[model samples]
Target: MPRSPYMHLPPAARSRTVTAVLGPTNTGKTHLAIERMLAHKSGLIGLPLRLLAREVYGRIEERAGTDAVALITGEEKIIPKAPRYWVSTVEAMPLDLETDFVAIDEVQLAGDLDRGHVFTDRLLNLRGQSETLLLGAATVRPLLEKLLPGLNVVTRPRMSVLTYAGSKKVSRLPPRSAIVAFSADEVYGIAELIRRQRGGAAVVLGSLSPRTRNAQVELFQNGDVEHLVATDAIGMGLNLDVDHVAFAGNRKYDGYQYRQLTAAEMGQIAGRAGRHTRDGTFGVTGRVDPLDDELVEQIENHHFNSLKVLQWRNSRLDFASSASLRASLDVVPREDGLARAPIGDDINALEHLLRDSGISTMAKGPKAVELLWDVCQVPDYRKIAPANHAELLSTIYTHLMQDGAIADDWFTRQLAFADRADGDIDTLANRIAHIRTWTYVANRPDWLADPAHWQGVTRGIEDKLSDALHDRLTKRFVDRRTSVLMRRLRENAMLEAEITSSGDVLVEGQHIGNLLGFRFAPDAAAEGPDGKTVRAAAQKALATEIE
Candidate 1:
């Protein structure tokens, strides 16, 4: 193995108080971290997902005031002058900024394949001046102790129990349940089935913009929908009032290959079922096989194998040239239980750029090579193909090297194509992803000539597309009449009934059926259980008016 690039660096002093709070999901580790952070005069917290960052940012802003809080993510930046608290995604954290307190959420992601290296780098290097907190699953406890000898470790017990409930059909699943699938297609299929049989389901996927996702989640939270269909994105720190979690698909493609979820992975998702002191359950749905007895037991008990290693990559890159940078990345870790991560999208894009003779020629000196590496770090949000993504980076790097910034006309053209709000769910989702790429570019300070102006433009387009997508989803999967009637029925409240001049009977402003000559007829579209629900609600509400 090659000598470690960091071996030559002098040892640095440790933080005053570096604490690792380890536990399973719903253990309130993240909440505790935030409380500790807010207690300090100045602090920073790095979350694993943009959604989580935004959530925490809002929480912090509520206490610290928006003027005292700053949010920094790859695609979104909200910085007030001299902000005292910084909430950012782990990868976007300003490690160089010193604060009295700092915290990193989901620290166990250091074992992840695609982005583990980033988490590991932050774990090893980033530190607060007076106190530092590392929050994640209990699986990382041993690794934390081994890696940082003097580090303090605290284990938190789950606030509520998680039990396995066995298998059920999608239609038979209970209310306030989240059905988990591994892919977008599976999530949509499950959601559609739930919508037909159980009123409707709110959809959640990793691809959704924050605005769109929050809207969908609101539907479920507000009781407009009884179920939520989502990918593994919910396994993160998304707090939902889910009483049960049903796995629609047990297998997922983990960047490299398709495989069954590990026991710990299942626990992370299943654990999201209940919040606070409320117990929750997990089980299989659809054609998925029931989890084995031992696996089920382990998940319920929050017992699983601890992580043995963390993915590592050299962050101290030698930007003198592309070759040197690559070489630095290949340097082996000097510590035990640290393995080099496989080539990620950034590396793949860099390799593609290096193969291009013209691009390689232009990427010569330290500054140019560093810039090339920076451009390569742009995420492949549109997962069309690796070469296509690399081609985009090439255009960006070439423009920066030649003209100092991306041309406004060219950038505007890209944004214009994705600006339209008209499209189906899939089309609108794709447009959101496309616009997200430009949004990420706009956030880069030096990439655009007018970063602030372009950022606002991209954000506005994304919000419009997100709203359109939300509307499309709601129209397709949600039966408005059914959801409204069901919610009112459950509340045991009198429904608002109205009959139009044309003899159309509407319950809560949702057309239920037509009334003619003292006889009521349900709409043709209202059939099955939903139709029955509407009929029952209409009769109860219109009894006095009809009499």
Candidate 2:
């Protein structure tokens, strides 16, 4: 009997008991899952985001001891030789390992246009020997009932109050505010506005590394910073002390197209403003038009569109070859009137790679498809333009297949070229992306003879690029008018500048400060103006030069 590619159950998955745990934000859905996972002798959790995966991994380790849990994401992996509990991003989840329990967080993303296929696949395939928990928004109930007959459905509620606060400007935002935007530029723009008016803001976005996001989140959580500017990525279980969420824009560009967020999405994002034990308010800002009254009311009232069909894609291993798989992908969307896998970017890149007649003609059978898919699965760490990224991937794929190993000099030359920073924000992002790609490649113990050395070197480059990007973002987004050198402006040959009796301080014809009421240099406090102080010898240097 041929099974629906969408529902091709792994043989063992049939023996598991499945429970669909449904809820909105602040609900105890994940909390319950964690409790169950801890209670079970061994367990695995699949999270939609790397950040969320790390969060759960840490919590599990704290309770189960670090060795009991393993963390795996596409770009990073930390695991014991025999991990008792595997915490991983959905695609990275170790399905081959059996555990007493399994849970998939944000299961409703199964209908997500691009990333949903993996979720649906996980929902259909991965199962624990004893228990399997599928966690997500309640909107998925119908789909679950239809797709998984006999599945148990459990619902949970918001632990705190969530309401629609009338839309307003950034300046009027409250403390503990989170300004959500769709694009990096918009996130930065709103964050900068908040910094100017409200001190500095913690910036969070999808492209940031897990470590970077954690540090940024810590800044907001510690009360050192009052506001956070982020993308919709925060909606998926990334908790914070947010009392308000103001949307800088209501629309977003999904990988394929720009579209209005669904009622479900709007509600998910708004729900983040409030948490257990605290009421939260949400609204629109940064010149974005307010959500239509009905949509606003829907989100406020928790009314959302129901899920009908699960979004899915063929993982049909029977495809004769990589070429055949691409052909099927091209035809299936049109044949079925369904969207091609939301996750087709990588495969699309692979197609471009195979465009060379030599590569295209040499491929046939499932083995070829598997090899191509493996190459496609490589992360686009460089985040270059899709075509350019695909071109590079194609080149690398060709080299790896033909040459077995990437040339050391070829890879090093790219890094050497990336050593310079561009002033333009987009260019800096590109450089960071390239370093990230290098870092990713460098981490593969199988790919490099000395993975540790290359990993360290690549990390140094990534860190340099990341720091440069943060510095650029901070300077552009923050209001630092109280001091001159604090702009981190280029240094001058002058020993140091003095504060004028009028309080106008400058060195070498540059205006520096009207001290923000700090005794002594307060150089660290004044120049570094981060909620954290950046110490400088400004005060001591100036005093010494004068004496």
Candidate 3:
């Protein structure tokens, strides 16, 4: 079989030491990896998240001059023109960039349903120039032993002890606690409650930009906030000064449906509480069910399931034509020595593209089809309909064929739309997502004559939009008091006229109902297809201030 290109590296790479550092969370696994990378002249570390990449990049740059380290992710690259070390998300790592030391964080993700194949590919392929280190859960040890014979493995015990203390009320959550929730809305709701009771709380979620996330975490770490409410994004490798872990809800929506968290996942999140040598405790809150006695005992005792097989996907499909690619994807149900991973959006989108006669017809030959197929692999962060994404790509292919460049006019217009920052939360999010697509396009430097300029413009715009969006999220979600007051002010604005006997406000001769908060029961005549009119009470409060 023609395997990954890296497998055929020279004897020097084969002679390098490969260490599998196995352990649970808070085991100093990542710290050990960092130390190894620093000991070498040049290094590359594969992080699981863009936020984590930024964190590591900053740390490495601080220690090893800014020009010595490069950071690369899907939509952003802070790669120094000449870098001695690389910090990158797993998918974005420059495979050809040789290094003295190479480390993969959260190596157990090699079995992840969505990204396991990428992780497994890295595991099977990466031959660092000097040394290679794999850091993650103990479950991966058995598979590593089977796959990489004679590989050295070391299991580290958690620096601090984790004890399951049963369930607790949200009101009873200890100080310096980190509460985990599944959704942004839930995280915000919990943070809002924490603000009311504990004065304030830090908030973190996957959608947040790295700068925003770092600032939010600093609030809790720097003692400005006693509590932190966040999503499972924390389960990866976010370090803070948290003393307790509280589950706002046991069940989390796994991009498919709401389901119970697995033992491994629970252990990972709970492990965040006790960092270093300090003993930590965890429990449930927000009416979530208590952990079963057996599970709780296993958690307190540090027992977790064993890994059986690693999940893998064939991203290295050798095909030049769309039809050949589709056929390969359809027929190759499994690969030798690797288990098939869950169906990803890329495969689904590729199928849709193949079926669409218009898009499929554009790729007249293998070379063209291969290029189009590469474009299809770029994940759509917008989460737009598959058909819409297909149409967008089809148009791009046409434009590329015509000018050998992306339709700069189209991207410019998108920037204008993204620049409109004064909008609701969903509007801002959509605009931000739109700008991200442009950023991804800009990632392909060859696709533009002035690629550097295009990238610089998009980056600045993205930063502005991200800052605006972060401000909105912080005010609407974290600063609950400000949000509530703003709502009150809006309601006050709409109640320009004194509360009429009928409880309707005569604003510009329109009978708008008096909004108690944002919504109100309208009088029979005030009802309309669009729902009741909102009394801008907050604006009224602002007018009083002006008076």
Candidate 4:
């Protein structure tokens, strides 16, 4: 029978319930998914990253109307009640809800080490027989097809290789080009160079918060800044239209440690060029360096390792009782050089850390015990949770006090370490002082009588729980081992410097994508003791570039 015009399904999806759309960067995979979604009456769009999820939510709301869209992520939720259109991180999606259509963004990440399993399970486990659209990079298509043979597959590559009108051997970038570096320190250095080389154009880096990053993106979007110095964080969301992207650093640190980029990573950065049709000229420029050569080789060779499994468990909210996992944690292994020391064979104090920290909310009973044994024996174990803030701090303090790992006298010598370690009198102190104000208000019976105070108390507990989470997840609550591991992962990649069509030089590297957008203003000059402007001319010279 001929389908009725009132039918809500896309013509392609009408026959089959599942559809997979795959492509590399710049192939408009996401745009296609959005179009398909528009054809349906209602749908759910799931993104991997919080930033991308938020960006998609904003874009969807702008097009579909505010009442139609809502956003949810691990840290934030904008949806007060159920809305027809939902945008959320895949992990944050409610398991109970039923929707007509589901769009899974970045479906390629299903092969990722940390959260690929989430995608796999979610795709495999979706209960509702709704039409599904899977969007991801080209490399991910085969994997998805293999996993779900019932789905239809569509593949697209980059329309054309980018080219530029400028000379090939150009030493410097042009006025309106951007140089992308991988690290915060290098980004700042490159910004300084832009000031020195390009008549002091203000450069924007990627380390700034989302609000600040958006502001920086506007400067580039509005043509307020001619050149931007930034990191990979700028690559995905802002969509700054630019003529060229130059690699500042050639390498980047992966989550666990520094590593060279594979073909997929390099393509992502290079693909950022010429996103807008108006900027027809597009190019990727990189300097020759050991790191750069390695990245090139990886891309050319298409060398990449199979995805590794990353096991992460929530110690706070997942399990009902913390006391259950305590006994098992008591017999785990300690120290780095130890071999497969089984809990049944060798007993160590380190194994007891989870128990001592009051975080027994792990895998239930026997499985929890089994996992603990594996964690102790396995060399790659990275612990994620341990309990409440007080338990965590108290455990660390107790251990440190007994072992004297951190010198006690250092706390007394405040002036010596004040520069290295932020002092009580610094910005954190001001924040802490506000607690006293709240305490005084709480002491008043009249203030306590108000319902607002009760809510405030609830908020305080949530804040404490959040802080506990931050400390544990960030390795702040744990010892130096976890912190060192995190640092190693962060420093894996390096940056390579290159020149763009605009006669501007930039640093670039693997994993560091194009500057989607940027915004920054030149610092204004300050007055000197003699009443003469100190660095006033420098500031004015810098601001002039923006104008």
TM-score per prediction, in order, is 0.96, 0.81, 0.82, 0.56
lDDT of 3 by residue, 268-370 (tens): 8888887788889899895788888888876776677877778776555646677677665654424334687777877776777767787677776776777
- Quick one: best TM-score, which candidate? 1
**Per-residue accuracy of model 1 over 1-547 as CA lDDT, tens digit each:** 5332112222233423689989999999989988998899989999999999999999999998989999999999999999989999999998667788889999999999989989888877777777889999989888877777777888999999898999998888888999999998888887788778778889999989989999999999999999999999999999999999999888999988999899999999999999999999999986898899999989999999999899999888999989999999889888888899988999999999999999999999999999999999999999999999999999999999999999999998889889898978999999999999999999999998899999999999999999999999998888777888888998999888999999999888888898897889988898888888988987888897899
Q: Give the candidate order by descending lDDT.
A: 1, 3, 2, 4
Q: Let me know the TM-score candidate 3 reaches against the reference structure.
A: 0.82
For residue 269, what is the lDDT in candidate 3? 88
lDDT by residue for model 4 (458-507), tens: 33533443333222222311122211222233344232333234423222
Estimate, for each residue in 1-547, the C-alpha lDDT of model 2 and write its tens digit. Answer: 4222124574344425899988788888888999999889889899999888989888999998877889877656677777788899998876567688889999888888778888887887777778889999988887777667667888887788788888788878877899989998888777776665556788888887666677778767876567899999899899798999998887888877899888899899899987787899999884887677898788777778887666677765445777567766554422221245554677667767677676676556666556666667777766557778777766666666666667778788878966775666667677767777777777565555566677778777766766776666656655443223332332333335667776655544444445444544332334324322223435534555445
> For model 1, which pairs clash?
none
| RMSD (CA, Å), each prediction | 3.2, 7.5, 9.7, 15.9
| TM value for model 4 | 0.56
**Which structure is stronger by TM-score: 3 or 4?**
3
Give the range where candidate 4 is weakest over 10 consecutive residues by summed lDDT.
526-535
